[model samples]
Target: MLLLLLGYDAINWFDGRFSLPTPGMLAAPCEFIDVVVTERAAVTGDQSAVAITFAAPDGSPLPAWSAGAHIDVTLPSGTVRQYSLCGDPTDQSSYRIAVRLIQDGRGGSAEVHSALTVGTEFQVARPRNAFPLAVGGYNQTTSAVRLIAGGIGVTPILPMLDMLDRTATPWSMIYCGRTRDSLAFLSELARFGDRVTIHEDATYGPASAEELLGDLTVSSAVYTCGPPPMIDALRAALVDRPDVEFHYERFSLAPVVDGREFDLRFASSGEVVRVAADQTALSAILGARPDATYSCQQGFCRSCAVRVLDGAPEHRSTALSPGELDAGYFLPCVSRSEGCLTIDM
Candidate 1:
């Protein structure tokens, strides 16, 4: 139970609780430290999912985490990416996370797939949870729980399966991927007996959220994580069940925005750049200073968030709420300005 307060906030790991707030997040930014990779291996036949175990550089026991917790790893390309902890929460010796390479992703996945190896070390932030199991505040009883995942989204739900089974709490899972080969941890998920149902897009019939969640009881809680399109469909399908709490983790950004051309003025650099209708503020900023810090160019990751000194922005990111927008913070990756804007680069 190592509870430490490195700054204004504390990462309390006592009693199985840990909190590491990131910048552009609601809470203040917390400390991030270095960790070494103990092992790295491809778990799937297609070699798309790479499972890597991380431990303290000095071989000290890492912090304890519960299901649905994720760690931010600084990839080799200097891109910070968040991955779900798919291994056992009871294992305090080390932390394990699976990375699924996205063919078209913005280099983070590619770096994780190719660069990470045994004996390699990288910086990782403490675990954080935007999604949690049916615990104290969830209001979900132990009677029944439903978990759903789309494609690589299954990473987060993997640990929940073990947690539910340990408590003897009845639960089920719906995993949907493009093809059978693309599904990671199928053998691990198969041990759940009839509790897990997988849907492959290559098959004539794909998994249907309506069919699986249509009969869900009002008392049940549904946890899902996936791309924006799949999540949007699930959200729309389950709209009628307001009593059912739908917790989700989105990996990618929302659909593209129909933005209008605008001007972005760097307050310190005295440089004004034009953002075309099809261009993003990040692209314009990068053109000005190629060495600018950024990752997950999709608005989902808050790495590109900057202080807005002036002008109203056409907020397209789900990461920032109305209060955050009013607080002079914005994600330049997908967020645009109304006409003219000034930012702190």
Candidate 2:
């Protein structure tokens, strides 16, 4: 027994404890609190133009965050919505979020317009960022940065503009809206003079993608946030220039009319499900098992990520990096399997 243990057992014991390093622990989700609205203000003449403030207990500042971070607000109706942090990051007395009522929205904004009042208490999520400013070496060069905003998509760009202003970095902004009366932050944008350009669709046709985005150089970066049509147009216009960094955020999901049906197999659970053309990969998974947990099903959130064991996945989500995708990880929310896929579950 001692001789046998000295051979294979010794190698196995050493490999178990000392051969490989322990994997790093996963990051824990941030916590948020329910705060009462202290003040409300209407910046624009429109009644929908509203500003709400939330304060932490003892009147101390909330957690420090970088520019371009957005806080998730749970309205009185229990609807979760994300609003960009419009207040200065350095000033932490309270968090500020500006909201405009979307008449066509599916009850979220409508609830805020009718139900939210001063002194109302609602749950709020800590600031999370999808859009972070490129700094250091990325900012040292005098590369042209263009920001295109449609309607409320201008929220995130506000803080970005503040950063650019402080750094004295040259940047340009093109804001498009149906009319001046409907647009928010008009006064603030007007102060930027020629650096900011406004295009009202009522007077002139919406800005053309090709015309607005002329020839692109390798040093240019274009950030766009808007409706599907605006994003599609920008993507089409810049499809030829792959070198230029194009960052965009869509407020709503794009309509998916054409997708092939596929099969998804979970290796760990030994479960398999067929996904239809009309059903998203996430929808199929959650339908098969109601216990599935996910946040931000639009692919912006990395909550529903799983490891791909076999087959290639058509990467559609924005959460994972290119290297991560190459390593067989995918977000089932907006992504689908190109063929039959086996996931670790």
Candidate 3:
């Protein structure tokens, strides 16, 4: 059966054939693919939108993806950033990503916003997902779904709302931005009637995290995506409620200089790196061995993740939930060694 499957995949690749994965194959993992940006446009004041078109080597559709899956785009400056697919997953023609230029960022968004143009080629890892929509339970019977987005965090939620509308699922969205003019998809979100709420910090007082989520019940599931300050605030405000499923995405890395010095021991390589108060474990590793691989040094990508064999990791990545952190996985890119730590590397 394994030989048959391998032969079939080979034939499909060469013949330009594509289909959904079988149940057995689905249980196995999928490989990443390369995609190219065929078109680009400036969508908002500081956001530029790009449409990436991918195909099999023989011009067939690539594997289908789910709604929340995101692809990592290797920018012109070699910085890899993950952007959620805003296009319909059912559509195989192309995938679209909207990037907001960050004035003070480490240059990934700026390079994408300024340099990338039509016909630019870049490699994309296959869609990997950490935030998938809840299917049954409260997600199914709930009369309404509330989506909270902060700034550029709206990209992933856009397609989710479309999918809900297509299924005639009742949902509402609250988009928070610094100002009315800075919000992306403002006009489109407004068309959803009172179901869509826009909060501008410049005009209305900043959206109160406690006030906004205070009334959440077991019947409702809340999805949030934004920077650390907002997510941290919301998490703290809603810490008492374990009944409500809170899903969120963060784009920022953990602070490296906040914690005290800690020792890190790599089991596989028998290497010990002391994480200084001013340096992260990843930085220490890369400083000693410059060939270490990493992307999105923000901890959003799992590229720099190492298995924690023992001791606690001061996990600071928004990529992993509390459950995953408890399971002993650590993203060394942004996470610091809380104390003496041993990792499988």
Number of the top TM-score candidate: 1
Report the lDDT tens digits of candidate 1 across residue range 222-283. Answer: 78777666667777776766566677777664444678899999888879999998887887
- For model 3, what is the alpha-carbon lDDT of residue 234? 74
By TM-score, rank the candidates, best first: 1, 2, 3
The digit string of per-residue lDDT tens for model 3 on 115-162 reads: 666666666567766666654435365544668887777877777877
Model 1 CA deviation exceeding 4 Å by range: 1-30, 136-139, 212-214, 256-261, 268-271, 274-280, 296-303, 313-329, 334-337
- Residue pairs with clashing backbones, model 1: none
Instruction: Give me the candidate number with maximum lDDT.
Output: 1
Q: List, residue by residue over 1-345, the lDDT tens digit for candidate 2.
A: 010100000000000000111121111243658677777766455566676777864676677777667766767765566677776787878887777776665566666656667777887778877666663355255367788887767766777787777775567888888887766677878878988888888899888996556455565677776777887888777766755667776666555546788999877677889989877887787777555545455565455666788998988755677876777777776788668888776
Q: If both were scored by lDDT, which would come out higher, candidate 1 or candidate 2?
A: 1
Alpha-carbon lDDT, every model: 0.71, 0.66, 0.63
RMSD of each: 7.8, 13.2, 10.5
- TM match of model 3 to true structure: 0.72
Task: Report the C-alpha displacement of residue 122, candidate 2, in angstroms.
Answer: 2.0
TM-score of 2: 0.74
TM-score of each: 0.79, 0.74, 0.72
The whole-model C-alpha lDDT of candidate 3 against the native structure comes to 0.63
lDDT of 1 at 28: 27
